[model samples]
Target: MKNIQVKWWLLLLLIISTTVSSCEKEDSGNAGRLTETDFMVAAANSDLFEIQTGQIASGKGTLSEVREFAQHLVMDHTTSSNELRILANQKKITLPDSLTEDNRAIRMRLSGQSGVAFDKDFIEVQITAHDEAISLYEQATREIQDPDIRNFATKTLPILQGHRDHAVMVKSKIDSF
Candidate 1:
């Protein structure tokens, strides 16, 4: 009878342990990634980087097409950034006023180049940045816990995808030249 009682107690303990473990796993997952505040900051930094790089290309690019593309980047990214700022303001989220360290490094590298080199490097940067932006917005749309942020992501994703497609096309043209 004691052995039977021991077996019942062991089964209960096993179930309890599993339940606690699963709960911990879920909590840690939320803590680990895709937090709303982190998403906002990242988005803002990307916008700032795009704006700054586009401004550089506008002045330094030898290719007229590259200059035109840079103008588009400046206009579109400015609009997106303003909208994001408004949203962040409404949500009481503070955004970074400058680019992240990685983007600042890109800006410095692009600043050192001019003419054809500048044009090529700027196209490459746009392609990579837009790709990353698309992925980030897509992930936020899918997994963000905050309703306002998720909705924003869903609305912004198509625009980011469009930018990515444009950048890819521009990169291909640059490669062919």
Candidate 2:
């Protein structure tokens, strides 16, 4: 009787292990591809970082143009964040609440500057960030498998390009000064 009980327990364990392994295999297929959840979380985090850095610039920048750009960043990114949140909710995705570690470090560095130095650093950072954002959106629009996210990326690329163009103009002005 005890031997029979042990055999049954072993069989159950074997079945459970097999099921779990198959599930894992299915879940991890195409590990190189970016998932929808990954895209959404990354998008949300980017918005948060931009908004935070823009707030810092608005408070610390001495240049009127820089302050105005910062305000635009805060407003535009905030709207994008809200739209992303609604889409994530509709899709049952949970986005992260804070910036990534790298972005937080950028924010920390930006927070330490003042006056013209702050304006230059802030504009430089914005240009780099916007360039990255444009590239990211372009990649997502081209490569993302999820249709909704791909569409979102397609719609966002133009705005990112505009921001990058504005940043470039600002950098040219700064160089002339």
Candidate 3:
């Protein structure tokens, strides 16, 4: 009788342990992963910042090249933002809708400038923003476990590189003037 009681207790413990383990796994699902979620949020914020700053540059920049580049940024980032939003929705990720404090400060600073100064500042901001975005996307491509998010990062990287190259070229031209 005692042997049977001991066996039943062990079985009960085994069942309890299994149930707890399964619950823990379920609670920590894919959506809880920081790498994927962080990448989406950061990407969303980046797109918003680019679109707003590009709009400002398009109107305030004195140089045609700067205005044209700004227009491209506005268009491209707007498209990217929409795509990201769809992806985030599909993945059940909540993305930020507005700029971060740092981005807000940059936008404020850019908004206060005009003419040549505005052109130079805008180009400089573009270069820096593209560099950071490229880094984030590249990291996401490497570290993200979600196949869809990784694919998004992979697809967007080349476009970001192109933007960075264009920004550099524009900066050189601005410096020469």
Best by TM-score: 1
Q: Against the unseen true structure, what C-alpha lDDT does each candidate score? A: 0.86, 0.85, 0.92
- Candidate 3 accuracy as lDDT: 0.92
Listed in order, each prediction's TM-score against the native is 0.85, 0.79, 0.81
Model 1: per-residue Cα lDDT over 1-177, one tens digit each = 999999999999999999999999999977757878888888888889989999998899887778888888889889989988998999899999988889999999999997777888898889889888888888888778888888888987887777777777777777777
TM-score of 1: 0.85
Query: Model 3: clashing residue pairs?
Result: none
Instruction: List residue ranges in candidate 2 displaced over 4 A.
Output: 1-31
Please give, for residues 109-136, the per-residue lDDT of candidate 2 as tens digits.
9888897888898899999888777767
Q: After superposition, how far is residue 73 of candidate 1 from its true place, in Å?
A: 1.0
> Clashing residue pairs in candidate 2, if any?
none
Tens digits of per-residue lDDT, candidate 3, 1-177, equal: 999999999999999999999998888785444488899999999999999999998889898999999999999999999999999999999999889999999999999988889899899899999999999998888779899999999999999999999999999999998
Model 1 lDDT, full chain set: 0.86
